[model samples]
Target: MTRKTVRIAMNGVTGRMGYRQHLVRSILALREQGGLDLGDGTVLWPEPVLVGRREHALRELADRHGLDQANVSTDVDAVLADDSIDIFFDAAMTSTREDLLKKAIAAGKHIYTEKPSATSLDGALELARLANAAGIKHGVVQDKIFLPGLLKLKRLIDGGFFGRILSVRGEFGYWVFEGDWQEAQRPSWNYRAEDGGGIVVDMFPHWEYVLHELFGRVKSVTALAATHIPQRWDEQSKPYDATADDAAYGIFELESGAIAQINSSWAVRVNRDELVEFQVDGTEGSAVAGLRNCRAQHRSATPKPVWNPDIPVTESFREQWQEVPDNGEFDNGFKVQWELFLRHVALDEPYHWDLLAGARGVQLAELGLKSSAEGRRYDVPELTL
Candidate 1:
């Protein structure tokens, strides 16, 4: 019956993902719900102190959310130096995240951040080592694992739905409009390699964790990365060279002998039910999972079709799959993880997804890019602290 308030220093609220997912949907949403119940007769309340580079944007966000203006500051150092702040959360640009996280660890604050934890594998490992040495609770954002569709898929896996998983195929991405005619949906930096922008670096980290958590740890990767759009207009309506790869096609070998092929592109148009989808095939059954829905076809119900080039085919192939039911309410993936991290910090609860896991993700990305450049498959070496 007691309330415990934990102050969180929220950095990079000016960015799209930080503003929408981390701030509004996660932290503010929890605040509106009267905090999280800790199951120990204690309500873990979160108080957010906005930290960013722009004073105007911070003030505007605070005003929009009806938050106290006094809690918003452009000085991240001053915020991190505050002893009252229990956690420092970052959703900033990948280029600037490492230094900020290191400073937070030095300040003795629990740190949580978005991945690719650093621009390189070495930097990611350094963050992990520093956080462990500092004895502070640290975490990296692995939000997709907590998604509802993935949850249902995991349930099926646990229930022996997919006996002896065979392979996984994932398709993710959408066409980002060139900024000349229509303003690009994504920031200009996403297409510039100099600014820590590239489809391979941006998404390979996600694929690493997703494949590892669901199927198996990736053992090797053969990839081909391309910049489909060579030129694009920036936010200022000026043309610039798009040096980064906008699309990547990769084949991954998993430790469990399962093969995973994934295609990530920002130039392809959507042809699936969701923006992203994964089709997992096994010896006993197969399932396709999107961001919110999962459908499965068991061996018993699967239809057999004959290959014919001359005859008209009508098998109702899509109808063969049965929809997975949502037996429980599913919250936003970001919000769920926030609550878990809050519990871990407040009650010393166990959390296995730390900065080391993030380093593994970054390692996959680096290897993937290398594989693409060399036109050869590369083995994934095991990383240790």
Candidate 2:
């Protein structure tokens, strides 16, 4: 079996999502597993060059992860200019991603990035056009679809268990500590509108792909957004006005005539089984999927509740649902997508999640914001490039 090493120029590995998900959990884990087998008796090995603005941070990260110090660099331009790097992956701050991707495309590097590829739909489409024109393979992360719970849900959908889908409801939120007392878990830039930070921009991309994959294309969106926490302390412990919307409530109309209501917030406290949960109600059954767990109830097993406002209900409503069994052990979602992208690049495999899909995500987010601004449902136009 022949083994080929694919050198990856990884930008923004120092950030939280970049460090943990992309670097530690995904790329490094793939390396530890002896790379990915291509089914054709060839193994594709991923060799990542960690790029960041801080030399000290990069050096420390490399040391902590047991990566070679020679692989760490502060000079992004120099790394992009390196002809040996076949792929350019970015998980950088959203505001700066477009320029970096443009440079990578110019350098003839294949592109892959975390969602909301660009803040604006136009910029995202431009990136797609450039990558397509340049004939470089490209992809955007749609990790949620590969999640174990969602996979189970997909299985149910394919099995005709749901019978005709009716609607999907998603609840996603967790309290984010304002930097006043406790140290904020998320970056300070997430709450600043000028920096391309907002719950709508950060999360609508996930919703877009999830809805499109499981249900259908989102036809229109009616949304309401707000900056619930007006003032917050920054990373430096100095007070600053939170200009971005911390929460967004959206109602989406699917092409299949299914209604999807998704609530995304950073200020709400968690009361559900997981940090995020999606409930799908169909004609024959209903299912709720969390991050790792999924439960369902068929029409036969569903309880018929009588309307009795004066009496206390004795039925165990939650216990009636049966847990969905794990048919097999599932890998990390991010790692799974990473492997697919690698295979797509190495084997010339068909990959649907490309720059155009990323642009669609951006389009949804832009239209969602427009819906909120106009206080009316905004039709989501299909993006073609």
Candidate 3:
């Protein structure tokens, strides 16, 4: 069996998502597993070259992660100029993604990046056009669909368990620290408007693809957003006015006549089973899917409750739902997608989650912000090549 080693230039590997999800959990894990089996007596190995702005931090991260220090560099332009790098993966700040991707495409490298490919819809679409014109393979991260709970939900939908899909309710969020009394978990840039920050820009893309892939395409959106926390402490303990919206309430109408209501907030306290949950109701059944768990109640098992405020009701409503079993072992969602992209690049396989799909995500985020600004419903236009 022949083994092909593909060198990947991974920028912004020092960031939280880049370091943990892309580098360690996905790439390093793939390397540890002896690369990916190509199902034809061949394997594809990924060699990640970590790139960042700081030399000291980059070297430290490389040493800590057991990566070759020689492979770590602070010079992005120099790395992009390297002909040996076949893929350019970005998990950098959203504002800088477009320029970086353009350079990568110019250097004749395939591209893969985290969601909200660009801050604006035009920029995202331009990136798609540029990549297509350059003839390089490209993709955007849509990790939520690969999640176990969502996969189970997809299975249920494919099996026609839900006779006629009606509505979807998504609850996502938790209280984020302001960095005054307690150290903030997220980066300070996430709360600043000058940077690409806001719950609408950050999460609406996720909602777009999830709604599109599971139920149907989102037709229109009516959204309300607010900066619930006005002031927040920065990384250096300096107070700064948070101009970005921390919470958003949106109502989306799907093409299939399904209504999806999503509430995204960083200020709300968690009262659900997971950090995020989606409860889907259909004519024949209802199911609630968390990050890792899913529970459903079919029409045969569903209980009809009669409203009687005069007396205490004695029905175990939550207990009536049945837990969905994990039929097989589930791998990390990010890792799964990474394998697929690698296969797509090496084997010339068909990959639907291309740059166009990423542009669609950015379009949703842009429209969502517009709806919030105008205080009116905005129709989502179809994105074409």
- Candidate 3: minimum summed lDDT over ten consecutive residues — where? 359-368
The C-alpha TM-scores of every prediction are 0.99, 0.99, 0.99
Question: What global local distance difference test value does model 1 have?
Answer: 0.94
Summarize candidate 2's per-residue lDDT along 208-246 as a digit string, tens digits: 999999998999999999999998898899999999999
Q: After superposition, how far is residue 263 of candidate 3 from its true place, in Å?
A: 0.4
| Residue ranges of candidate 3 with Cα displaced over 4 Å | none
Clashes of 1: 0
RMSD of 1: 0.9
Instruction: Kindly report which residue stretches of model 2 are placed more than 4 angstroms away from their true locations once superposed.
Output: none
Error of 1 at 205 (Å): 0.9
**What C-alpha lDDT do the candidate models reach, one value each?**
0.94, 0.94, 0.92
What is candidate 1's CA lDDT for residue 305? 89
